[model samples]
Target: MNVTDPKANLAALIKCPSVTPAEGGALGALTEMLSPLGFKVERSTETDENTPDIENLYARLGGEGPHLMFAGHTDVVPVGDEAAWTHPPFAAEIADGQMYGRGAVDMKGGIACFVAAAARYIEKHGKLPGSLSFLITGDEEADAVNGTIKLLERMAKAGETWDACLVGEPTNPDKLGEMIKIGRRGSISGWITVFGTQGHAAYPHLADNPLRGAVQLANALMEVPFDQGTDEFPPTNLEVTSIDTGNAATNVIPAAAKVVFNIRFNDLWTADSVKQEIITRLDKAARTGNLRGERPPVRYEIAWSIRPSHVFLTRDDKLISSLAGAVESVVGERPKLSTTGGTSDARFIKDYCPVVEFGLVGQTMHMVDERVALADLETLTQIYETFIERWFADART
Candidate 1:
């Protein structure tokens, strides 16, 4: 409940090994931390027969116009080989003034700073001028099926709405206040299988090899660039992740060849358009070389898993300007508004309210020896406190 020192709060949070779909007592810890601050906490467990049940928390304080929400995940990615780390990944060790842990930088640090900021704000202002709430989930690092998305649905069903939201994802690339995420690129993945006849490799004329067709398809997919750099985003990209024929013997040709690929695209193309383009290119490649008959070179089937994420840009002047002002006030520089990054939970939160990502520098996130600087922990807490005050102050209009 001591909000003065964010580093201490973060140290406590990073000690919890709350990996994906596992509570690991992280939410319980957070509940205890927030409850004493006058927040009414509610826990919801979402279960799917396919995915492990996830426990989430929704806590709020104050009741008035201009409700502001802070959204983040407590779950962390696996620590991989524990022996590879100098300090235990979940030990929350502080060495050279840096806190080392899996979720130390990628998130838990942000949550701690915000909570500390809220506590400090309450101490100074007596009570928040506007409503404040937290939407915390445990599935951000995993499939995200039973996390914020489900919670938002439930909130809607219960007639709850927010004016704005902030996701505590690490957005700074090199240093605190260097960058804030305003949008994110969409992602789509697919598997392409080119079918052919299986036969002895010794007799080339007798067998139809699918590998040749697959190579051609891959070449075609990568030959043309998806787009030139746009004004707001970089060029779209597609990469072949894997290619397999499952043929163990050199003398035998497999019946089918498969290639898996992923595309990180900008707003220029939609999921439907990208899939159509792949199909068009593959169709052209399939007609290239003839086998034994006068028909097409190979028969093929393309299966696409297009999980579309609509590109969102938050240009809300009040939301952007107030947060930017706060960052300037605390860190002495206004952060750049960027859309460059892999997708995040903000992708889902954007649908409900105008959301931006601002937190610690992420250069160490998801890497070996993930850590956060002790100084940064305090500075981030100051930034969040300033933003909270400015956001509520501006909402009065």
Candidate 2:
């Protein structure tokens, strides 16, 4: 089987506007495509009181040991200003050898290529050498409250596990095979609030001036470096994203000040350690700062958002070597194993099993007229097919 042509499959997927939290029939289309290949496809919908019900799919073809899973999401980010595009965002039009659509590069393209690759592998070998499965979700781009995390729980409850997993997120920055994400930097967000007395600006002796305390606190946090980084990750960084006092008048000092900051940390620190460091620095600053008699010294409260993502590295030799070999075979160059990106669903999947991300060049993902080269899609399909073959052939079971 020719795998039903990856380009055609991608075009069909692009036509479905399955934005975050909405299925848009994309999973249905996938199920239809996989069912004919002797795959046992299961569609699961997870519901939460706070989030919309999301539809996910897990499909498998072989059932023995050494299971290899391909993980991805079908949901595309919102298309901003549809009229601004040269072609419709959902048209999936192929012009000048490029497929233009919202998710052509970000993700849908990867799913299409994998499906075609799997079909071709089965056609050539009559059956996969080992188990093959796909874990797809529809809530990766939004709050993520009801997406892959829920699906993984369901899978675990059902006694499912994998030897290794590949996340088909768009990882390449410039070229098709320049980078493969082997790890990701950890992320943490914090909100700091400082309390003081409010008074008229004219009466300097009466006003406590919370802004002054906030400024001092911000300086203390920014003055020192978080860490020098490790061999696998870059140095940690903290940046104040916003500062708010809610004061509108020029003459009145605000009673409180708030600063919002985020840190993209490395392997050198954990969320608790980072928080403790911040508190220590702020306390030191507060002790040294001066304030009017009517107002007490600077007092602050710090709150953290969701739990921070712990830095993770994938060192599994077999998974890395096989995927890298396949990439080199198809792209003519060994891809760089990098950990220099933001975050992805892999942050959640890493807890379950070792995971690596590789896919098409992502130079235009989440940008206007987002698209992928038709030739690149074909090449990626070949790479996935090759990787699947080699990975299973090398399996012990």
Candidate 3:
């Protein structure tokens, strides 16, 4: 197979239907592509107590210093309403100028392009000044417990290290070379359940409606701003995603109400600090019992999500310049260094090395008809190829 062609590489991958936690032949297809290019490929399956096993791939070409790691995932979100798509979700069918599929842009397309880029670089330049590695995971779209985090730990224990990393998550909003994610906001989620007495709604003072306390607590979290905003990040924002009482009858007040919330915080606070702040706010509001009408402190219990992604920024000047310069060389403009967007596996990669992200436009990620333009695939391949050249040249000096 001609692994240097981005479209062919992507089509082979997209046909695999590798939904979260499933191998689905995606890694096998990747192995076939990389093996011919002289990469020593290895696949490892990660297992945990509660999480399903996940298969991850790590392949390297060359074993020298200043190694570059390209990180991404092959797992895709489920294809919703399969009948609604004009092209089959796993068919990799090209209509007009775009290829339609589940992981086309978020992002089996990125993986394909990077593979093609590395292939093209090797074909033209013989060998890199140092090394290049691919860290691909199959559990990114779902519970990440058995994916990159575990793979990174295992690899590090085997004495593997990287100088810098580029995560190929789709970063462009509308077009290629428009933005590169240099940092990401931290994220945390929690559920608050407020307790009360169950009684008939007709008796005004007979029952304490937990809904009132839930509303007050939810309001307290949203009413106050976490921070004005940071120089490198936006202000911390929290949203009350759900409020449930599970009460159906109009005449009855429920015994408990649950309020679920998630917050995306900026650099001004760490996960611990933000968590503390949330507890403080909830405690203060619970004490008032304003809507409880002089009742005892609102009875409530809080449970946080198991994993809290911490905020980070990449300050590696040479690494940043090499990628930005490549984008400019291909697309005729320097990409914006952005910190917007939800968390990605880059959050985990950051603990190991300085990491940044750039890839295809993200206009249709996870949508019913998720797809990628053929042109964007070719262009991204060129940009990745150029980035490889620039980074290795910079590292040599």
Q: Provide the RMSD of all predictions against the true structure, rounded to 1 decimal.
A: 1.9, 2.2, 0.9
Q: State candidate 3's TM-score.
A: 0.99
TM-score-based ranking: 3, 1, 2
Q: How many backbone collisions does model 1 have? A: 0
Worst 10 residues of 2 by lDDT: 288-297
Candidate 3 lDDT by residue in tens digits, 1-397: 8988999999999999899878999999999999989999999999999889999999999998789999999999999999999999999999999999999999999999999999999999997789999999999999799999999999999889999999999999989999999999999999999998999999958888999999999999999898998889999999999999999999999999999999999999999999999999999999995775778888899999999999999999989999999999999998999999999999999999999999999999999999999999999999999999999989878
Q: Over the full model, what C-alpha lDDT does candidate 2 score relative to the true structure?
A: 0.88
Candidate 2 stretches greater than 4 Å from native: 1-3, 248-251, 289-296
C-alpha lDDT score of every prediction, in listed order: 0.86, 0.88, 0.95
* Model 1 local distance difference test score: 0.86
Candidate 1 Cα misplacement greater than 4 A, ranges: 289-295
lDDT of 1 by residue, 197-292 (tens): 899988877778888778888888888998995787888898999889988998898899999988888888777887788888878877774434
Looking at model 3, residue 123 earns an lDDT score of 94
